[model samples]
Target: MLNAKSEIQKDTFEPASDNLSERSSILTEMFRKALFRNRVQLVGGILFAIGTPLIFRFGFDQLPINSSALSNTIVGSIFALTCGFFFFRRLIDYPGTEGIAYAIPIFAVTYGATVIVFLFLRLDYSRYLLGASYFLTVVWFTCISIGMVRLRTLRIGIVPGGSANALLSLPSVKWREIREVSEPTENLNAVVVDLDHSFPTEWERFITETAVSGTPVFDVKHLRETLTGRLEIEHLSENTLGSLNPDHMYLRGKQAIDRVLALLVIVLLAPFFAIIILAIQLDSPGPAIFRQKRMGYRGSIFTVYKFRTMRAEQVGSVDDRDRAITKAEDDRITRLGHFLRRTRIDELPQVLNILRGEMSWIGPRPEAVPLSMWYEKELPFYRYRHIVHPGISGWAQVMQGHVASTDEVLEKLHYDFYYIKNFSPWLDILIVLKTIRTILTGFGAK
Candidate 1:
């Protein structure tokens, strides 16, 4: 148990462990391939960053004439690059006007920062320049947003059976432009067929022809993974689990970075931490900190910490499954507790866990021991997420929001598997940024 807990405390820049040496050689190639896969977006970002200021300078001399052209160009360039980063990094391309909503906050911050800098320098501010830049950005981004929606739209034809029904029912389908139909259409971008069930010769020919034509044809199970960002548990097998080769270098580096970041955040938020402690103590009779045994890396059990958000209660047995899950309207939550959970102030104490080497700043969230034991019994390949240290925030938490109940856990596992298989610094960065949005919006909080 101690060995497992200490895995995180190891030097970040050093090789992970003896166990990882065999895999390190291939890990770099895999990450290089994944991170560089979005080369078009990368190139586009650079071009826009360099080109936007020049175009604005030509069209509207709103830029401060006295300031160096380079200095005047910095704000708009930063704003464009920042927007493109978050917009293009998403795994699921949100469709339609709703997709634009995601960029609003990013724009506000970057643009606001630009204005603040101008005021700080007491430079001659040009309202025309600011307004012109804003107008040009909206027009530019609107076109790109439409293109993104169109690109995400996949005209999929699936035989009516197996995973088809479930795929159609998911709310997540709205994130992409997917249109599933019973019959194969000439315009289909892809085709999904269940291998378990037999289809007519005509259907087989349609699938074969689609493949021949270079339109991608996918197995129903693989399509589920692609669409939902989770491994489909119903079809999970040993072969699938065995195929996962986690990048040890990336994991170790992420851990080192997480610890350093957690320490810095803890130091910065120290004043807020004291205020929270006092509030929790005044609002409830229990201790300010709550700790419970959670399944950690390699199934090691460790105590996880959080601010107390419920009334004082005795610890229960591992078999106490009924009381294990936190419900949406749980009455034991105090007035301050409700506020804490909504804003995620309740989780601030977990920085200690990160510092202690039991958790990362990002990964699969740890499940309580009782809940973990129950899931192990109920779900196949449930323990696979424990391949890495549990996290304070994770892919599932940001994408699916807070989950409860067996059905939700099953769904959450899909995302967890996706994270495990696709682990990269880019995905972790996305999770962290989205988590901030989730916290501010009070999304999925009871």
Candidate 2:
């Protein structure tokens, strides 16, 4: 019995030793990772400084044909490198619009760098669109890159109680510490954090030492603003978005172009539209022309029109219960209706909505007034969308798919707000381009 006990004790002791060593190594690696993340902005600048722009312009123009072996290898390697970099770095957080928002600058920088180099290296660079594009691209890229780096490192992540929620989203000490508060009933900007994991001795020392000497710590909104290049509204709270004013929101003149383009579209597509109406009428017993009262432009209601895609009895008319949500493969859809809806030909009459003062070409998709009534009460800043005229196509429509429920509407509302805040001509161009692309892709069609 004594011999057996001695052997067991030895075994236990060996594992404990191994556990300590393993922990030490893990801790060392975490420290290195944290430091490396903190230094990304500095490193990005250095990498950018080496004139990546010039290299791209030369290489891109001369890039061999797609069928060439060298072309295939280089393209494969480049794409692989980008994917590896993003995936390994966890550069993308949430997918969909969130992912797109984060990635925009990365592309801008990649192309922009080539432009900058061309301008600096070539005397004739001023005559080309490349240099100008580079200049434009860099502004967006640098701002967003700094914002992301700041977000990752908590550099500009926090404002006076305004740091982004992403820091808490990260798998870090702060993430472990923040728990959902049930009792207080008040949203918090900052909270005392605790962790079962031991704090790094170096980090503990660094925070205690340097944090006291007037270096700023972040609030969530600060980081979001930095990352998004737009001031973010605060969390859902009693005073949440109290300062938010609908009048403060603006979309640029290019949106007017969206309106004009929409008009032109109606004219150009008029014959096809006539045929669609004929088809809808022939396919279903219901009227081809359907008009509904939709809320638009600061709570005013207007008659919106569409080609009826549902059977006369199966679908609700404008005056019917006003339950606007439609499901995928809904039984209501007629055979021809399905095809029309999928291709968005049913929405052609919205060009009339644009012509009429009720809508823009690209803004928020108008909802039924009764539904807006419920949403305005349920979702904070929901009415903010009404600040601008409703549009036939919108940022949310292009960036995300249809909203089937209240949850989806609220989510789409965030994208709408983001668009409202960053209403520039460039954004409008992108939205229009994307709208055309969507019409081609049919990704979100019924």
Candidate 3:
């Protein structure tokens, strides 16, 4: 087993081709380094997108330039490209960010916002220039993404033992097992070890030396969580629970934003809401709105609202946990319910809950009363998820979908815990993107 494992490690981290002696010119080396730096990429891409247009329109006199139009174009293009660049950069730091797939939509949103602002202010702007800027922004970032993927390699050295071996199965990283303290570390981006396991004196010294030399040392368990986007909790402790506490300022700020946005949405979609209500009443022969008591923030039970999708006569007892769980293709779901549930349009009414401070736009999904009670009893530290206000859409909803079985819910709990552990705007943004995809694909819908 040892020999076979060694063989696999050898194949995984085959040395790069011996071409180090062939040094390029000084200028070329500097250019190569600068090309890979993210700051350089951001500034350079913006300049290329904006400068090329200015030079074409004014420098070459290709088109008659109006000063107001020129000024608006320059400011708008810079704003859009800069915002898009940073947004893309921050999102890629999180797990599950699809390479280059977000480029077009992100740029579209930034540029679209710029256009909205322009129209709102009734400012003159050249559509052609802005359009070209948008196109070039996507193209430049796409090229940068392709180049980085081809040029960069994440090679991690593993100190073989305990859970360290578990990370070897994860893809998107080159794993090299360090069998001896004498193993080379120059090529590795970082080193990982099972910190919970005792190490020999030499291996302990090696870990110290590696860190002293400026290489990052990571715990195998934490690294696994980072790579997999799940946090496994086997026991409860203050240190463990302490780390899961979200930023309170962001929490408060998020609540305010959620309510404001909810108000805006309710006002904007009022007409559409009426139409859905009428349709639901006609289809299901019951109240257009379904209200249920749900387990909410800090163990509070709150009334949650949704467009009625299930048949009225099929309503089950509130104490029945089984009925609270929506099974796959259940007969209780009305025809409109299928579409509403599939598209998550059923969740629209929950904006009122957000307005009421019982929920946010994103967080853990609150379970029905009985299911929540059952889970708290069955799952250890399950109530920890209530630290933040429940969300209309959540990390678990986007990642794992709707789960009914206790075993499946256990896994979903891990996802929820992971969200709480790494709670921030970036993760929320990623969830929002994933939620969009989920809606389109009808994933995790009952």
Candidate 4:
């Protein structure tokens, strides 16, 4: 049997060794760098947006308009583009309208800001100029939106593997025309292959020739993880897990920053906290704060705190604790509890946990002890999440939402593993921003 352990190099899935191919082609290596494509597209889009003002200026200068109108036009465009950049930067990875979902909010905010600006400045421009500005802006964004959707819909080839089924089921990737491996073809964006799986001599030769000719090659496992944003547990082994060493220096720095920020948040939100406390007291008989034991860094257990969102229930044994999964329309949830849970204000109490060094501002969410124990027993490499301190909001929390069953929890752990494997401050910031959408939509709240 071909060894299923042959690993692909990080990021650049360049061939690990010469066994797969005789020699790598210069064009293939260049094409394998997909970041270059994204960068060029992004830079092109930004230049077009920045130049939009100039386009309007040229046209408006011919019309009977005051200089202030031109200045206001430039200012409004800058404001809109600035907001658009922030949203686009995050949404660019997603496919279809989902990639541009942030644009709707940015557009609304920009429209409001422009209305206020025009009102405040009292700048009266020709109706034609005003109408032209709005029209051009819409046209610019609409064309770019179409371009991005088409770019993401490129045909891709997949050499089937264990994760192929999962990738096939994801909606975001449904836009991609996925095909089985055949003779080398020039019309494909990228090819996903199982590096450890064997192929016929002719098939292997075709892949080598295609890869060397500037066709980007991707490992099936890595591509699936990138596309779905989840780490498949079945693909991981001891060597891979062992390679994820926690950077002590980085952790120390992150922890120090987390504590300071948590303290500041608590102080600022004290009034809101008091209001929530009062609401909880009036809504239920349980203590305002519910303390539960959760597994933390390096397998350490810590008491995590959250505002009580459910009725106080008696737990008589371990079996009862094991069955404590929250369900939709659960009778134990109070009216106020439902609101608090949906809004995630119930987690505000965890700021204290962060201050106490039991958690960070962002990391994997700490699973309750009973749930953690059950997961450890049922899931592979579940204990790996404890490598870092738990967090109030995490990759899993934002991406997968609240998991209620063993199957869902297994899916969540995939995201948790991805976060652990690729932890960075920028990623945490992105998650924090995305969490706002969740709070607003009350997505996945039980």
Candidate 5:
């Protein structure tokens, strides 16, 4: 039978093994992750947008401008602000008008959701001009999305000013030169780069996040020979750059924002929060509020609080990465605590952490001490994240969704840097609004 089959066909086959294919698969994953952030961005953008109307509806019920006019003005202002931020895409092309497309849709949804929710809860759309707000948001996003699709700004180039996100963050990508790059997506930024070089997925993620204007991109072949000094991976070709930033870390402004936000949260959520605390006491034999030593703002150790989500027996069962990072159906989670964790009510206890000067309203999340030290020893600027104070929600939480690997930490750090470099009260407010949406959607709670 073997001889007959061999004589009949005599064909030998081998599975595929191409370096470029390997690289492409890795990077494509990052790109997909990066693009997913837009979901959060979109939701956050919508909340701030729609929430504005709710505020105005409450505040300016008797105002000079009509609801439609007010919505248009705010949307116009948002478009105007974001439009100017573009570089190569904005300059020669329809930069200003393009981003309006995304802005408008998000704003529209936000206004609709916000006004509706407020009306449902508070019964006061009398002030909001919901129709006008929704119209403006729709119009704005339409314009912005059109511009983005045309410019493909998020699709190519060397990106900066945000987290060290995976290249996959961009919505779509197709290789102009398959021989040069393997991944499917890229950022469209001011930095003109030739993808005519190969890079590993981790390095590709770093370049998308940390490679800045002055850092010269080396041809893959030239990296070892031409580049000198402590060869920053940012200067290397996409191929040589490894899986992810082992050293990626960030610290945002901690003191002032934390104080204000924690106090405010405690005051606002006090009653509901008390019940959560009570539920924790009923569920297990531990403190209702679990306070554990964590690495914070620059790796400094501090106690971070939460309503104990796990049983006491499970407390030491799993490590932080395995145990603490919740999945969709983690059994370690308690019954009442399940609702709390899903709703992010478990985090409400952290407002006390903010009050205690351990974290900010927004920034990188605090790592457990052992995890922090372990990462620091292995990672390249892992401790740099602590340059500022830790935050409750920062660039990483909203942008990257959740952390799973050392590679994710590196990717997230790029985003943390972007937020830190451009830290502002406005950004904090934006994050807070986004946090609300995250809680509602439970986008990355797992």
Candidate 6:
């Protein structure tokens, strides 16, 4: 067991001399404020990355202002740089340091879109200019992230009592316990307290004053959810924040977009799908497509599709509940099935489910009918996950993949609740980026 007070005292930094410390503090604050400001980072990125290149290319008379090359360069550079910048900013707010890992791929997607547009329109553009912009954009953000990591240490003040001590176990945060009402608060990034716990009058007054004095106050439960990307709900009413009720408008809009994109993906990947189907058939004597009943959108039953990676004969003899659980090194998985599952090629057919409005590109992954039924019986409010459409790639899938045991599923439920509670474009974008990593690295596939 950890002693919260001792741990916090050990982590706190002590100053040397009053005058020397004051001068150093002033300089550090000024540097931190300037460097960490979003506007400063944006302006610096645009000027150094986009503006410098523009000056050399067009300002030097090497390219005319009205020329197609000049226009394409401006449009493409600005598009890639701005998109990458904001995407990085949003992702950094989520828990984890892997936000920097996404910088390259985000730039790649934005720049690739520009190239695709230029090709389709038959417009003349300097490939070298766009490529350089992509490179510079990535380098700029990466450097800024590294600088922030080195310069910034989050100092969060924890109010002693209740479950506040539970947060001490979390890493990368400077935890300072507020023992006295008179404890200094100016240096603290935020104040964390267990809102559920009743505090004495002095501490209560301190919390009120802390909030009114401009320092942010956070409930320990919410802060932990933000830091860990998991939401553990002991009761249905614990979701009183109405995070249980996601943006209805976004949900509807997402479904429409999912349908259109699903159709487009199917159309574009038709030939590739044929190749996979042929490979599967050649490897095993079974139907190329595997269909299973799954619990989907709002507890509805739907048939989910996947490329058959398992032998046909072996699947029927097992019990439905037992068969639904894919154990590690399960022999039922054929040689090709292992590769397919690892790369998630087997899930490609779920585009059909998305087209049918039974699923989305991202949300909670649906479970097999038998498994879903069993879980709903064992777990509290399990059907609440079906409130949103089931997804192909989701928070739980990326965070803790391919779980089977009820204990593991309990933890997976927390991830799902986090997704449902914080359901929005940012979380969805994070899932998409993480899913790309999952595809390449096979982090969570069975």
lDDT on C-alpha atoms for all candidate structures: 0.67, 0.53, 0.83, 0.67, 0.52, 0.82
| lDDT score for residue 386 of model 1 | 93
Question: Candidate 5, 340: how far from true, in Å?
Answer: 1.9
Model 2, residue 253: C-alpha shift (Å): 3.5
- Taking the tens digit of each residue's C-alpha lDDT, what string does model 2 give over 296-323? 9878999898888888776674444344
> Candidate 6 lDDT, tens digit per residue, 331-388?
9999999999999999999999999999999999989988998999999888888989
Tell me the spans in candidate 3 whose CA falls farther than 4 Å from its real position.
1-36, 54-68, 113-124, 146-153
TM-score of each: 0.71, 0.53, 0.87, 0.73, 0.53, 0.87
Better of 4 and 5 by TM-score: 4
**Candidate 4 TM-score to native:** 0.73
User: In the order shown, what is each candidate's alpha-carbon RMSD?
Assistant: 13.6, 14.0, 5.7, 9.4, 15.8, 5.2
Candidate 5 displacement at residue 370 in angstroms: 0.8
Q: What TM-score does model 1 achieve against the real structure?
A: 0.71
Q: What is the lDDT of residue 251 in candidate 2?
A: 48
- Deviating ranges (above 4 Å) for candidate 4: 1-87, 94-97, 103-147, 160-184, 235-239, 246-250, 313-319
Q: 1-446, model 4: which lDDT tens digit per residue?
A: 01111111112223224444544554444444443244544454445654554555565356434577665665565566556545555444421114334554545566557767777878653344444544454455556555444443334566544344445665633224334445445655666677767777765776787789876777777776666677666656776766466667778999999999999998999999999999999997878888788889889988888888878763223345544677787777888999999999989899999999999989998877888888999988889889989998888888878887888888988888877766766466567766878899998788
What does the lDDT read for residue 413 in candidate 5? 63
Top candidate when judged by lDDT against the true structure: 3
Question: What's the distance in Å from true for residue 205, model 3?
Answer: 1.1
What stretches of model 5 exceed 4 Å from their correct place?
1-191, 194-254, 317-328
The segments of candidate 6 whose C-alpha lies over 4 angstroms from its true place after superposition are 1-29, 54-72, 112-127, 238-241, 316-319
What TM-score would you give candidate 2 relative to the actual structure? 0.53
At residue 292, give the lDDT of candidate 3: 89
What's model 1's overall lDDT?
0.67
State which candidate, 1 or 5, has the greater TM-score: 1
